[model samples]
Target: MNGGLIMKEVTNSDPFTIVGTEQYNMVSKMNREYRIFVSKPSEKPPASGYPVIYLLDGNSIFGTVVEAIRIQSKRPEKTGIVPAIVVGIGYPTEAPFSPHRFYDYTMAQTDQEMPFKPDGKPWPKQGGASEFLSFIEEELKPKIHQTLKVDSNKQTIFGHSLGGLFVLYTLFTSPRSFQSYIAGSPSLHWNERNILAKERSFMARLEREAIHAKLLIGIGELEKEHKSNIGELAKKMSERLSFYKNRGLNVKFIQFEDECHTSVLPPLINKSLRFSLHSQVDQ
Candidate 1:
């Protein structure tokens, strides 16, 4: 949050920009250069410092999240949204999303585990999720902490699609890394639904020690209708929600009406922000 961004003018020649947000490039230990975006609230930080939300697909949604936080957090009493730092991790690409996400957002899978592409094409190079998580925990986070005051106990991570799958992976394997998670339309069916196996281990860990973390899962109602291969995402996700609830995890599940995969992102991003930051506003 301490990264300084030169405020650029919003004009025909200059193009528009998010005023309070900063963007920088950092290379991971894996030698992957990522474009990092940070947006800090104008108000002073609370005694416990500001809650932080790390977002996947930074190039696509960084401004949306920044403006939502800027507008809604101004009146916490009415909005129930608190001032928080937003960090978006993405790639240095002119396009909205980089193709490299397939690797960064998915678990390692054997050739047999991966389903063939519908177009009869070979899959992109993938299965670098472990390294991606390492980059976040070991490299990116430490740099952010050094730059700003963040509430370690209130850290939240959010993702959608394959990124959502990574969110679940982080929760199951490294539950203590974040205090809350928001997974929107996760690709649970990936890798032959291997995430189900990870859930079992996560439950076992929870039974042995108390790890209080909040999870919110949201899926558009028409997801199944839009994508044939997904095969009843709402039903599958609901089952997972039940499993987490039975294990005594704090969780929330929502199915947005008439929304499909692409159309659901904006509302899901807004809902995720409120879900993660609302309760902490009064505290």
Candidate 2:
């Protein structure tokens, strides 16, 4: 099938048969409609609850994610990773899409011009991240939890570029949103604002009550001029880690030496998944 859509029929006697793919259309508080694709493992009975990975830019990465999860499910020994459900959040279009993602993902919006606004319209109208988090906490999470047998404690959020910015934002602003965060080539340069602000603030107010999480910040070593700027970014990220050194949070920063902004995600996803899983197991 196109887009790798696959379906399997199961008999009543077969409890371990693979369930076919399913699609969902959800409307946000803003009345914005989003298409979500969910894929589950081909296993049986106790409806084996699995981990959930919410992927941003789902339309672009959904197929890759599904394949990756399938491969892992089939060869856990080779991948050294556990099979999980991938929740792909898709946008309507690439441009108008920014506002939806920005509103949902950002903690706050400054007076920065959103990249790739074709109409140049005032963007990010609904940027109260708390509301978005509420949607996830009260709505999406509950829906997924009720519909699928998933480990509530094993939720992960994965994003790239601007989406990466949102992932980091959620990590600090809504610390309990997910158990693991994977940010690839985050637009650290967004709005000329430093994510460190949130990091530092969270550090000051951090409490043991916060959900423990694994934070993986990935960057393309070949991004931009490959000069002092990259070094500075890494240094600042390190400082954040230093601040939380004795805290319960687990943070890992990686620089792919040969990857560029556009090319870093594939490798980052693979490495970040393994790292996050390993860290989780260690804990």
Best by lDDT: 1
Q: What does candidate 2 score in Cα RMSD to the true structure?
A: 7.3
Pairs in steric clash, model 2:
none
Candidate 2: regions farther than 4 A off = 1-19, 45-48, 93-99, 111-128, 191-194, 207-211, 224-235, 278-283
Q: TM-scores of all models? A: 0.89, 0.78
Compared with the true structure, what per-residue lDDT tens digits does model 1 show for residues 1-283?
2368777676666668787789999998789999999998888999998999999999988888889999999898888889999999999997888989999988777535565789988778878889999999999999999998899988999998888889988998998899889888888777545677777788788778777788877888788675444436635655665565545567777778889876788888888887889764111
Report RMSD for candidate 1.
6.9
Cα lDDT of all candidates, in order?
0.83, 0.70
lDDT tens readout by residue for model 2, 1-283: 5579776676567434225557678887757677777887676523446878988878777767777667765666667667777887776664324457766666555655555456876666535556666766777778888878887777898988778877877887788879888877776666236466777677766744544778787788787465336534644675566456456677777788888877887788777667654424322
